[model samples]
Target: MNPIDPQLPPGDPLVMLGLLASAILFAVGIVGFLSRRNMITMFLCTELMFQGAGLAMISYGRQHMDLSGQVFVIFILTVAAAEAALALGLVVLLYRRKETLSAEAWKELAES
Candidate 1:
């Protein structure tokens, strides 16, 4: 016998809530990434988007009684870590050369 009731639909209240939360998070991340001029803040906004994605994956995995979403979340975590490290390195280099975290400083580097 199947563990999950085949009669049950995927659009249950719990899943709907999770999906809505993820959408909101992604929207906030997009807004923050667009509105912020600081390099660090922009990178953090990207991370926020990743978090929303991870949460959505987990929720969907649970809804389907599958493990793939959890596995994908692990991959997402790995990528997020790598991105953080690279962003930090870039921020340090940019700060050293321009003494500022504002992304506009990058333009000066190209012009000079």
Candidate 2:
């Protein structure tokens, strides 16, 4: 019987490492999103989630030899940029109103 090679090829190792990093980033983002009450921390967690998604997409693209995954990553980056802009605007508005950046202090809205 022939034994399979224990060492992974270069591509395989890179894919495995990317997947592991994505998983860790996802886990940490989830934890931060749930545990933090600050708006900035929540925003950071969202960015982390975006990063993990991008990593997974890039890894899959490499494995498949396709450009679609990279295109998707580009779209994700665009969306993340928009999200950051909007979030910062809202944070500024909130700070102006409450003089604080805590999530708990953002209960009232301009309409109410």
Candidate 3:
């Protein structure tokens, strides 16, 4: 009778809502990654996708009463942090040289 209890089955409305929200987040991330031409925005979109994956992993772990999903999220977070640091460094360096954050600026690096 506890609405907040996560014992709800796969058909539960709350579980369904979580899945829908995760899916929407993933879709938005993909769209943003594909449509955006800015390096920082695209990197942010990638983080959004990572967040969606982490949410789904945690939900599944909770449903199964397992801690592995939560554990995996820590790894995901670690990787995301590393990725953000490297990406931001690259963006900063590229911006300093080109004065813009556009993805097209990378082509110049490739030319040399």
Candidate 4:
């Protein structure tokens, strides 16, 4: 089936597959973010979640024969780049303070 048919019949298997894959990616990211304590690990998980969101958007846009998803993806990529820079700075400062990347180390900063 052509993916951009503009009128995908209901219960399109390809679209459903795309949605499932996106959901799995998002779920893994959430799990990683919640279970990991390392600052860099959490940042990576957040990036994973962003990618999952982008995939979902793209899948829906393709299903609807629209280009808005590409635009949103560009925006998402820009934000992700900014986020990476900010995370890098924060990680450097955090490491300098304690020489560790664990989130638990942040409590010292909060208490002071």
Candidate 5:
């Protein structure tokens, strides 16, 4: 039996709500990322944005009753996991080198 019910979409209220949530999440992330000066804060914001995108995909998939969106979300999650791991490692390395987590400190590295 097919798991996903084929829902004809003139409009699904749930889907609309999900999309709205996704947009809000992405917007908040963007604003946070832009405003934060700390490396860790910036990474958290980026992760938030990634989650927003994944939510959007899930919402879209539900609207269309297709598995493709869910499939993409799986990939998105995979990438997010890898990104978080790498970001943590980079943050640790950079912090040890600079003794500070501020994004502005990167400019000093450019001069060398």
Candidate 6:
């Protein structure tokens, strides 16, 4: 009993849809990264990029029936968690110093 019906051939529509979704997510992330002035929003955009990467990886893994891609996604998620922690810390520090969360406020560091 082959699970995929062995004779029907592999349907790739899911893979294509996953790729398309990943592309959309990546594009949105890029746009947000470029246009947003809030540090929290920027960090969220970065996370969106990571999520897109993870989706792409999982889709690839499913298409190939391999575990390595999923393992890579796990590693990416771990790194993303660490990045979020660091980014939140920076946000708190910046807010304390500037009393604002706008990206423009970061220029204060440059002048000093």
Best by TM-score: 5
Q: Tens digit of lDDT per residue, candidate 5, span 1-112?
A: 8565568546688898989999999999999999999999999999899889988999999999999999999998899899989998999999999899999998866856
TM-score of each: 0.84, 0.82, 0.81, 0.85, 0.86, 0.85
Write out the backbone clash pairs for model 2.
none
As for candidate 5, its clashing pairs are: none
**Ten-residue region with minimum lDDT total, candidate 1:** 103-112
Residues 1-112 of candidate 4: C-alpha lDDT, one tens digit per residue: 7576758656667777877888999999999999999999999999999989888888888888799987899999999999999998999998998999999977766856
Model 2, span 38-95: residue lDDT tens: 8888999999999999998988887888999899999999999999999989988988
Candidate 6: TM-score?
0.85
| Residue 9 miss distance in model 5 (angstroms) | 8.7
Q: Per-residue alpha-carbon lDDT of model 6 for 1-112, expressed as tens digits? A: 6476778966889988998888889889999999999999999999999988988998898899999989999999999999999999999998998898999976756856
Residue runs of model 4 more than 4 Å from their true location after superposition: 1-10, 109-112
Better of 2 and 6 by TM-score: 6
The better-scoring model by TM-score among 3 and 4 is: 4
lDDT of each: 0.89, 0.87, 0.86, 0.90, 0.91, 0.90
Model 1, TM vs. native: 0.84
Displacement of the residue 85 alpha carbon in candidate 6, Å: 0.6
Give Cα distance to truth, residue 29, candidate 3, Å.
Answer: 0.5
The count of residue-pair clashes in candidate 1 stands at 0
Which residue runs of candidate 5 sit more than 4 Å off their true CA positions?
Answer: 1-10, 109-112
Arranged by TM-score with the best first, the candidates are 5, 4, 6, 1, 2, 3
Off by over 4 Å in 1: 1-10, 108-112
